[model samples]
Target: MLNPKWESIIRFKCPDGEVHYGEPTADLKSARVWTGLDVWSLQPTDTTRHVAEILAPYEPTTIIGIGCNYKGHAHETGIPLPNHPIIFRKLPSSITSPTSLVELHGGDVDYENELCFITSQPARNVLQDNALNYILGFTVGNDISSRYWQRKDTSGGQACYAKSFDGFCPIGPKIVSAKALQNFQSLRITTRRDGEVVQNSNTSDMLFGVRQLMAFLTRGTTLPAGTLVLTGTPPGVGSYQTPPRFIKAGEVLECEIEGIGKIQTEFTEVNSKAA
Candidate 1:
């Protein structure tokens, strides 16, 4: 278990263009720099710096996405709830800054607001009850998707291809340790598209809780330290909406969790030749 004395941590750019890890203040405007090299054990020095820019918290060893794990999401899509967790892999290349732009490939892009958790240690065959002990911390992620490639008819039902594009997964603002959240359940999650609320739900809507997913994922599958798992998104994704609302180029998407704060992302169309 990562019993971090610090409540939160953030990787940010200093005024001099150097990058360092520090503890984010309440307003997230400034951070107290850490002198220690090891992030798991941070010793906050007296030095403090203004957050010139907030970067993605960690470059994960692996990015795992859970599908149809929310009851309302399942019901909306008319897909049956899984007896087992439905999981997919997202390449590390998809990782991007929490405040960065999500490139528009060909429109039909969808938004999924989810709770993301990172593992503290190698885990294989971990039991459900002890799963929490393996978690390092929690943060929210916006699992951006390209709908055309995600459909069964086009991509043979594989989600990785559509979801692995550059900047497809923009996660952070900062990371809040699991010890601080105490309970993952009952936390309110909200998503806004162009300043209008579209997804509003709670962590309670999850068909599989954090413990269940951690145990199931580590069943004979070793997840190395820093593995990021995006627990399923709640109901009200753009794909499952009536008439299916897709993202437009130059639009903004924001996903926020109750305690950990929010991440705002904008989308821009990328030309195939230039991409």
Candidate 2:
């Protein structure tokens, strides 16, 4: 499991033009450099540097997603409450920096603000009671989906293809280590599009909490260290809006989690259709 001593981990480039992993200040504008060779096992140095850019925390070993895990979201989308987590995968290549610019592949694009967690060590058949021990940290995520390919005829009702386009998974701002974050539940998660509030809800709405999700996902499956799991989004996604609004290219979406921090993703068109 991850070293519990870490407060938060952020990857950034300093003004001197050297990239390094460090612990961020409350505002995230500066950081105390981590001098250790292995970033996973963090060791702090006394030196602090001005943060020039904050990058994605880390490239995940695997990106696993859970669907219909929020009660309000289920009701809004007309999807029945699931007895188990609806598992899906997004290719690691789709992972992008916190401030990345995504390319729109089709006209139907939507955003799902999700809370994502990373595992610190290999885990298989982990008990719910001990699930927290295996977690490294938690961060903000935007599970970008393509509605056109999500149809039954195009994707055969599977989520991978419709959601695995490049830059589909934008995670981080920084990772607040699991042990450091006292309360994962009830954290306020909100999203804004061009500074307008779009998705607003608390983590309390999730049908399956972090512990339950970790336990369920590990049953008979050996999740590797660095495995990143997107623990579902709350209600208020673009798809379920009254007019069925979709996110368009060149618009910036900011997803913020109470304790973890915020990430901004801007989607751009690469000869794209209307969204």
lDDT per model, in order?
0.88, 0.87
User: How many steric clashes between backbone atoms does each model show?
Assistant: 0, 0
Model 1 poorest 10 in a row by lDDT: 35-44
Residue-level error in angstroms, candidate 2, position 55: 0.7
Residues forming the 10-long window of minimal summed lDDT in candidate 2: 35-44
What are the runs in model 1 whose C-alpha is more than 4 Å off? 36-38
TM-score (C-alpha) between model 2 and the true structure: 0.95
Q: lDDT per residue, candidate 1, 159-225, as tens digits? A: 9988999999999988898889877778999999999999889999899999999999998889988
Best by TM-score: 1
Q: Residue 30 lDDT in model 2?
A: 96
What is the Cα root-mean-square deviation between model 2 and the actual structure? 2.3
Which lDDT value does model 2 have at 239? 82
